[model samples]
Target chain A: MNINLTPGPSQLFYTVPDHARHAFKEGITSISHRSKTFESYFQKATEGLKELLGIPTDYFIFFTGSATEVWEKSIQNLVENSSMHLVNGAFSNRYFEIAKQLGKHAQKMDAPLGQNFSSIPITNYGTELIAITQNETSTGVSLTNDFIREVREKNSEALIVVDAVSSMPYPALDYSQIDSVFFSVQKGFGMPAGLGVWAVNPRCIEKAESLLARGISIGSYHNLPTLLLNALKNQTTETPNVLGIYLLSCVVEDFLRIGIKKIRQETDYKAAILYQALRAHPLMSAFVKDESAQSKTVIVADCGEHSIRISNYLSEHGFNPGEGYGEKKKSQLRFANFPAHSKEQYERMVDLIENLR
Target chain B: MNINLTPGPSQLFYTVPDHARHAFKEGITSISHRSKTFESYFQKATEGLKELLGIPTDYFIFFTGSATEVWEKSIQNLVENSSMHLVNGAFSNRYFEIAKQLGKHAQKMDAPLGQNFSSIPITNYGTELIAITQNETSTGVSLTNDFIREVREKNSEALIVVDAVSSMPYPALDYSQIDSVFFSVQKGFGMPAGLGVWAVNPRCIEKAESLLARGISIGSYHNLPTLLLNALKNQTTETPNVLGIYLLSCVVEDFLRIGIKKIRQETDYKAAILYQALRAHPLMSAFVKDESAQSKTVIVADCGEHSIRISNYLSEHGFNPGEGYGEKKKSQLRFANFPAHSKEQYERMVDLIENLR
Candidate 1:
């Protein structure tokens, strides 16, 4: 069997196929979102999300199409004129661009590729909200808790948001430090793609309402206020990806059974093993040099032209990792260490990588 | 086996379980969307949609969250300032409200519940676009071809968009009379909800470009230009419901194999038997009066106080139809005749309905 290790949409959580069978046999996917049956599914999924992530009761969670969509909705509902972005790679930079595309005064602090905020005192420059990418999937870099805590301390008046897309369930985020945070399921949750989970506190709702009072059109249908109203009713404003939500509930339950602390510890262990193997490789090395900034979930290696040979060798062993993104597409490889990957798999993968010519 | 006669999310196409099983075994859900594997799935789905729907070469098909989303997107891309709508019931009226919410000059012509336009010279009120819910799922009302043709001929200069949400693959819409149209797969296509298919011709793209040139912010990401630009690459602006798209492609191929003409004919026959049985019922009759306006797929009946008793009987017999929408929630039941429900199942439903006390 080919062991999928790509960052997003990587490997099925082993339990998904069986859970999907249950969804099909029970007609879970075919039930109306407004029906009591569907409401229960929705409730289970959202509640699981809260318990697994330790989300506060005051924080409201909403589902969107993808995490990329959360970027658009955030700018629409939270910011009136200006927003700040800490851009370390393509995904973070795209969030900044989304703000600009929505006709906002978007300011960005740029960090070079494969690098993240390692120091304190990141400024938002009077913007109404600051977007921090906690995990940069594109370059396998991440902002440390020290830097994030510093940002929260300095920008108490501004709305703080984080993209925990590729590193969630492992992040154990302090909800008090951020008003809003979002992620997609395919990465950290080890499910199929399509559903984006967005958690926002009461402050975020208040900000959205204020925008509405000021005659700002948040959106046509998925206005944050509207999403909140439906979420309160235990459903979404539109017919959602019911199956995705249901499967996510199953995986989150598994995560709960396994516990988040164990998942986080395993992720760190796997990441360490991969990085150590990268150091021994002839043509590959850890891309993010700073230990504090290196991502524990998505580990990148600068392989130059040897990426192809390494990939071929891994493929022969029934292993695969995600290709490098953007400008480094041809010269780097990103290995995801999400919960779907076990310690045994990582050890085997490390052996193969170290054995590569 | 309970026959899922509910309009949407009612029943899987039966082939779905096997296809989903195949998807799971192949790790289809976990692959990167940008990979060649995913592109092939995207290309297959879009191309299959075109073949099945007879979508012209110039028309671009894009996948969105749901048909409810297409309502917002149509307003964003096809209209600059003003648009007109034909509102028959809740779903159609919601589209009109979406336009107003998006800060557009939205005008509407309202029809009472269970009514449709039998006569025409249906006007667009000099608006740039006319939004028509081709088959309004709310009350099982539909606009006839004659009325759609009149609107097209009367306002040749304006764009004409359609919402075929709950009644596509059955309505052989004249794409020549419309600039854009969309539908979700749950209803007529017999798939799970969450993906909306939008087809827009070159004129729609031009209108969007002109609006952009005029400095109007058409929101962010999933913009028409960006969607089309990425569609040419067989992908989307963000990570899409990759599995949803894959399943839809499989279902559409099945549709092609059985042929659209056969599906429509089967729908008509099934609707006829159900409506005929409704006439024999003591407490229910066809919700729609005009024959041409009665939906072929979503056959709604005015059930009054007896809806529960009838629903209970049907439930005992292993069958369930959809509840009424909006104000008619408890007073009506909607029987859906999608391709997934076999002829034998419909005949059995008729027997059950006719024998109801």
Candidate 2:
């Protein structure tokens, strides 16, 4: 009965079928990784993901442990000596941490919190890779498609990697120009957490191959090349989240039933209504500076004088508004509208916020 | 009705409770990585893993994509020098490949096909770590506790990692002497395969810390330190298999009720029933060279002349035995027995095999 407003693990709109439930009950735990039944599910999920996301036919999608893992994987496989990072929020800043940890040469172009890199000025930083967060969930800011294309052109040789953790499927980006795109399933995909999805271009694959061909050994599990080989066959070299795979397959099927365009439009309207409600509230104001850059799926707002009190009030009223994600923890709250959310639910959420105001 | 004896992705014996299912349905997917709920689950899973395994209080456990992921994590995080591998079957052999891929020196004491590791005499030639499979599911061979303890005492300085994927929760190993133990939940735990649990000793933590202190970035997702910190706080840095976590919790509760000791005894009896049937069958013979080394959880056997034909026949009659894993393809079948299995089910499987024979 809890209204899950916390970003990432947002609400799922569908129930998993009884057949899948029955499959979980009887011990089928010993089946090997390459088993036919598992392969079927794996094949379906990979194809479903590609189709749902409109990933280029040449680009292959694979699942990993988390986007955090993909962050490291992208660096290990793609970055030769140096990479450029556009840091706008918490999740964005973590990419530099991952790059530095992997002993890669990484330079950061950081922006203040609640601000986004709508356009990164052309920089001759001598970097082979440029990583940016498409949607900064912590600050509720987004980098639009035009911005991404500009950044890609800014450093043509620098393979672009987009951390689309919070933006995908709603504040949707055209990933044609990017070399690699990373996001976790729990957030935008509307499935349970723990599965990270990545779309890798041929250039990224070449980078991975070069790393392996040379003696620069990237760690297993996170290695994109190894994962790609297995993923192509609709199987992972490691044990995958079997139930998550099943649930994700169901979620994808649901997504197909309600076309992506419909889902996107519905989500956009939901975001507009929620934003209108928040802006009308006397005690709250939007967190992001630019309206264009503001995330359509999540709203970051600074609660007036009694942010904590208001958040608690909303929670008490059975609507859970999430605590701030970044530096403005006490003052800001995040409200996310996942796909399949109803207008009535947003209105009710607004009603709870208004009562608190 | 399918007897998924294909190793992992194997048959799940227990049923998931309504609470777990309800949590899964009611937005277990919606909780963000930053949320207190996910953090609670993470911390509880770590603690629960330790408690269930009777691991020492000083030990820390981290979850990963799979045991295969750990192979890379260990190589990346712990192996500064060469590693010694004890290869009895398919899974064990892969470590050598992983080690080579990671640019680490590796020495292997390989057993012949259908054989167990008889001796792994450690040499001081850059062997900082020694890896072994406690139970070789491919060959149904198990390394005895006495042998493991002897090897550990002999090479006290060397980090010992045991892949106990197929032998955990039954015929349990003492975690005190082992530095790191990796097992997927699917095999002996009677859960799905996506979750890999590692019980790491203080030495392993020290190794990780030392590596981090030395600025050896062990990638983000595979970074055990980050995983432990978040796990200790009851949260994962990424989305976790929340349904799998809930199911594991339920399964663990059931195990606690039945008692691991009682469960082991029950598994032993069930295995004996199958083993007895294997001996009685004229067409079948145990794959493992030594009966003492045979796995109590899985029984691997070779059909006299037509392995696939026999497997197909038995499968048609509602008994699905596991095929040989990896390069040790075809010609062999395996039977898996765990705590959740019933004597009646074991008898039925045995009868099917007998009738088919």
Measured by lDDT, the strongest candidate is: 1
Report the C-alpha lDDT of model 1 over B1-357, residue by residue, as the tens digit. 877888887778889888888988888998888888889989999999898988898899999999888999889888888999988888889999999999999998888778886543455479899998999887888787778889899899999998999888888888899999899988788887889999999999999989988989887788899998899999888989999999998999999999999998898899899888877778899999888889988899999998887888888888888888888889999988788899989998788787777
lDDT of 1 at B201: 93
Which residue runs of candidate 2 sit more than 4 Å off their true CA positions? Answer: A16-32, A118-120, A354-356, B17-19, B25-29, B32-40, B119-126
Report the C-alpha displacement of residue A9, candidate 2, in angstroms. 1.2
Model 2, A47-161: lDDT tens digits are 7877887877888888777777788878888876898898888777888988887888788998767777644465556688898888887888887788888777767777899
- The alpha-carbon deviation from the true structure for residue A30 of candidate 1, after best TM-score superposition, in angstroms, is 0.8
TM-score of predicted chain A against the true chain A, for each candidate: 0.98, 0.93
Candidate 1 chain A weakest ten by summed lDDT: A116-125
Q: State the lDDT at B190 in candidate 1.
A: 80
Off by over 4 Å in 1: A119-121, B119-121
The residue pairs found clashing in candidate 1 are A9-B30, A30-B9
TM-score of the candidate numbered 2? 0.94
For every model in order, what is the number of clashing pairs?
Answer: 2, 26
Model 1 agreement with the true structure over A40-74: per-residue lDDT tens digits: 87788889989988999888889998998899999
